[model samples]
Structure formats: structure tokens, C-alpha cells
Target: MSDSDKAFFTRASELIELANKQNQNKEVKTGEISASFMYAVARYNAWFGSTSFETKEQMQTHKQEMMEYYVERYKEMLEANMNDYIEHFDHYRKTQK
Candidate 1:
């Protein structure tokens, strides 16, 4: 792999770690935001790493297709995380109220 690829992987791993830490905390909103941002960053990295198109138009088309696939996968993972967060928060809130 290239240095750029290694750098991107390192950054992505750090972001994933941050998201994991957030997942262990009490704040659902914070965790959701962190996870969402991580997903976006990973998707961006994948696009950067995978594209072979040289022209602007071709790059845009490739990016769009990749982004669509990313979004679909991200949505499923995000939904699961959000649901778990919501359930935990709701249970905690009930104890407080």
C-alpha cells in the first residue's frame, strides 16, 4: 500500500476508536454524532482509495456510485447504534423522572 493509503487507514482507525469510546458513554446524541462522522470519513477514504477515473466527470460519477453504496450500509449500522442508544437513554431517563 501507498503512504497515503497507510495514512488514511490510520486516520480511519483513530476515528473508529473515537466512535467506539463514544458508544460506551452515556450520551446517545454524542455517540450518534461521532459514529455518523466516522462513517462519513470512512466512506470518503474508500472513495479516495478506490477511484481510477482521471476526468472530473468520471470521478464524480464514480464518487456518486460509491457514496450511494456507502450511505446504504452506513444507514443500517447507524440505525442499529441509534436504537441501542435510544433504548439505553430511555431507560436512564425513566429512572430520573
Candidate 2:
């Protein structure tokens, strides 16, 4: 991981925490930001990490491969999270009603 990757993720975490606080204050629950936040983190780690490539074409190729792998994992994790959230919400609603 590069400095940019660490810095971006740390900053993103802080911003998301602030956004959550704002949501709490507003009495809102969107349940839509976590996966997006993680996807950005994955993208930054894949694109911003230090890499030594001999040529422009090499760098481009590497980036494309990295994005492919990262994006696939992101999609899988996002779907899993969504499913977990749906199950949890269903349970909560059942108990509440």
C-alpha cells in the first residue's frame, strides 16, 4: 500500500463517520453508504498503490488487471453486505411489529 492509499482510506473513514453523525442527528437511516465507501477504498488501493512498470503499456495493463480483480471482489462483498443488511432489517422489523 502507498501513502496515498492509506491517506485516502483514513480520510474517507473520517468523512463517513461524520456523515453518519449527521444522519443520526437528522434521524435518518439510509443504509446505502458503506458498500460505496468500501468500493472507493478498494479502487484507491488498486490504483494508487506504488508500482514499478517499465513502460506506459505495462502500467496500463497492470491497472486493468488490478481493477478487474478488485472490482470483482467489490461486487461480491457488496452483494453479501446487502444480503446481511436485508436479513437483519427483516428480523428487526419482525420483532418491532
Candidate 3:
């Protein structure tokens, strides 16, 4: 991984650890959100790094385009995951009751 990727991973890891910290008043949800954001940034950075660009402007444009394409896909994935989790939660609740 590149230095930029490493930085992103570090930030993401920090968020994950922060989420687990007992001292957090807002708690796990806050950390999870931050961690997710960091993960996306890291993914974006990695994506940008994977491509070749001759100019700074070209690289910037490419990054923007990639983000535009992937952000929607990421949202869809998250929604689907949330739906599955909700379904599982409902089942688990029923079983517990």
C-alpha cells in the first residue's frame, strides 16, 4: 500500500478503536460512522492510486469521476447490508422473545 493508503487505514483504524472505547458518551455508533467514512476515503485513495495520470488536473478529474461512480455503488451496498441486518435482527428478536 502507498503512504496515502496507509494514512487512510490509520485514520480508519483509529475510528474503529475510538468506537470501542468505553469513555465515549455517544458510543459505538459514532465511531462506526467515522470509521465507515474513513474506509471510504481509503478506498477512494487506493482507487486513485491504481490509475495513471500524466497531469495533476487529469488525476484530479479521474479521482472525481471514480468517486462519482463508486459512491452510488457504495451507498447501494450499505443499504443492502442494512436491510439484511434488519431482517436478521428481527429474526433474532423473535427467537429471543
Rate residue 45 of model 1 by lDDT: 71
Task: Encode model 2's per-residue lDDT on 1-97: one tens digit a residue.
Answer: 9999999889868886876765665454545454565666876685664356666678776877777877797799779878887879978678755
lDDT of each: 0.76, 0.71, 0.72
Q: Measured by TM-score, how close is model 2 to the native structure?
A: 0.49
- Model 2 / residue 77 / CA error / Å: 0.9
Could you give candidate 1's per-residue lDDT for residues 1-97 as a string of tens digits? 9999999889868976877677667757765776688777797677674666667777676777877877897799779878887879878668756
Note the clash tally of each candidate.
0, 0, 0
Model 3 lDDT at residue 75? 92
The runs of at least 3 residues in candidate 3 whose Cα sits more than 4 Å from the true structure, single-residue gaps closed, are 1-50, 91-97
Top model number, TM-score: 2
Q: How large an RMSD does model 3 have? A: 7.9
Model 3 residue 61 lDDT score: 70
What is the TM-score (0 to 1) of candidate 3? 0.46
Clash pairs, candidate 2, are none
Q: Model 1: which ten-residue window has the lowest total lDDT? A: 45-54
Estimate the Cα RMSD of every predicted model relative to the unseen true structure: 8.4, 7.3, 7.9
Q: Looking at candidate 2, what is the lDDT of residue 77?
A: 71
TM-score, candidate 1, is 0.42
